[model samples]
Target: MKFTTLLFPAVVLGAACPYGTYAPEEPTDTRGVCPMLNTLANHGYLPRNGRNINENQTVQALYDALNLTPDFGRFLFKAGRLSNPMPNATTFSLDDLNRHDLFEHDGSLSRQDAYFGQWSRFNQTVWNWTTQYYTSDLLDVQIVANSRAQRHTRSNLTNPMYSLSEVGYLFSVAENAAILSILGDKVTQTCPKKFADYLFTNEQLPFAVGWKKSALPITIQDLVTTFLAIQSATSFPPPPPDDSSVDIFN
Candidate 1:
């Protein structure tokens, strides 16, 4: 199925948490990670109400929630950098990381960590596939350019002091660029022409209205809207028809 077909439903379904279930008293705290996680959960990117706002998120938990372990492992192998292995021989989970204190269950996930993880996952899935399948170099260029365009300092993000808008802006920029690069010549055909045009012009995405304004903290709603916009613009090739003997994951 198309990437949008496969992933958009997840984003939509993420909005179905039981009423008043995981609503934190303060959902806009820049220093807290709960709002971000809650946003992801509510939008179907993660399990709804799976975690509390103040609970520390382990690297393993994040990877597991995102379903990135196996694919990331495959990417590492293809890059000729697969060294360590997780307990399960068939997959690489974050529990294998060598940092003892960092890998602990209660280890606080830094904003820097979240950004790097997102970068790695986006590189492995979108960038690598686009480069290989379409023989394109646009994604590589965008990745390099975006790395320099980042406005937030590592200290600020790592200290977990970022507002919701900051993270949303960062995500929108990187993700929009990735979508544009991957679609390439087919962008106009695949996505809404206006959305594609906006991305091509490097204009600020309309979805980032309020959050893009200041250092103001963000709410789950802001994240949801941003994600929905990104999802709406992305399209991927359809998967092959299923057959009992065929392995779809491969």
Candidate 2:
């Protein structure tokens, strides 16, 4: 039988966010850093791959870890930092990476996948101003994280492929921007077209028979083209001074 998973469809997306009081506090003081680390202590997620991070008091020591936002942390955790975020979105559930089938309930994603996955997750997932993991996806990211997940400064995603998660996140960002723009909201200037192209090409790129293809709901090109059109509308292209001054046949 052909096998395909209904991984993270809209129905699943509609599920209530499992977030509890985990509603992270504002990134003010680093006093409760240990508590954050403790959150993963019993899980042994730290000090792996020869980079030993003290599970107890290290997160707090990072007082200089500027821009330490909660969503950022969640991004890391899901992608395989703090922990492999959707470690097994491929196999089991997207709820918990640790519980994912990507690895043993015993741990995170497998090594081969981790190697590639982490590379993409760090560099691309966060949408850095310059660098990008051009043709990667979440599963691609999990490939690397499953292998070499750690708290090392270098381990931070530095891969050079584009990930679908990055594309999806960009779509969400664009959608949010479009909503704000409709309501006359101030929007940031960010061109994710390159990112969209990167992900699209990768999604449509051929893979070996044994490898998994991208998880897009449709063909890669169509999806990319559709989103590009949507996002392009959000770009701050100069409009004619007045609608009356515009021509429909331009």
Candidate 3:
């Protein structure tokens, strides 16, 4: 699918604490992503050990710049990658799991019979806010008043001004993305061509797999911890019926 050229350096850029604290311990070395991204990874929104992006782009330049990254490796990997349970192929969502909705019929929304309706928006929020807060650092970074931040070191409270509901939503959104990817990978064969490339370039899953081959127990644990840490941080949509309003988010 040729994603390198279509890729953005979102993984490398840093995000600002619009409502919370913005004191990062150190700069994330990803050439493309920023500091916020680093926090997300460290906190588990993304796979712990992933790509190191640098720089960013917008407008047509964004497209042009994304096109410059390599996509072939990712595509090749996805086309043949197998699900852990022995599916013939990998799922497109390496991080998400409850993606059964990708093909299910929904009553409220069906812009058409042939199409499944709109693409998922969870990723959009992550991407949008990722771009949004980073470009325009605001002080409204909302970490819920009673959230874990309250228990964390004052210095470690990335942003402590948020109400609990606010932080819960953010935490929910991030956690959903990561878990859904993992779960989604479990159910499918032939990882989505587009996502495989994205993961290969952004999450550095390939590096983790290679580490496993060396048979170093510590490295294997490192790989798991990294992936787990990232997976543990972010979030994706809930399992269907996705009516989380009544179900409550974890």
| Per-model TM-score versus the true fold | 0.22, 0.19, 0.19
Candidate 1 Cα errors over 4 Å, as ranges:
1-40, 50-86, 89-250
How high is the CA lDDT of each candidate model?
A: 0.31, 0.27, 0.26
Question: Considering lDDT, which of the candidate structures 1 and 2 is the better prediction for this target?
Answer: 1
For model 2, give the RMSD to the true fold. Answer: 22.0
What's the lDDT of the predicted structure labeled candidate 2?
0.27
- Tens-place lDDT per residue, model 2, 1-250, is 3233455553453343231111222233111112223222212222211123332223322221212233323333333332334333321111223222232121111111233443111133223321232223322222222122221112234423322244334533332232122111122212233322332223211122222222322222333343354444433224557676768888
Give the range of the ten consecutive residues with the poorest summed lDDT in model 1. Answer: 102-111
lDDT, candidate 1, 98-184, per-residue tens: 222222111111122343343111123332222233323333333323332332332243535333354344443434333332222
Indicate the residue-level lDDT of 29 in model 1.
Answer: 23
- Model 1: per-residue Cα lDDT at residue 187: 24
Best by lDDT: 1
**Tens digits of per-residue lDDT for model 3 on 1-250?**
5675445354334343221122322343221112223333333333334242212211111122122122322422232132122454332223221222222111101011112234221233324322332222211112111121222222123323312344333333332222222212322211232332233234322223321111111212222333343335433334566564784545
Clash count for each candidate, listed in order shown: 5, 35, 64
Positional deviation of 33 in candidate 2, in angstroms?
Answer: 26
Off by over 4 Å in 3: 1-98, 101-117, 120-126, 133-220, 227-250
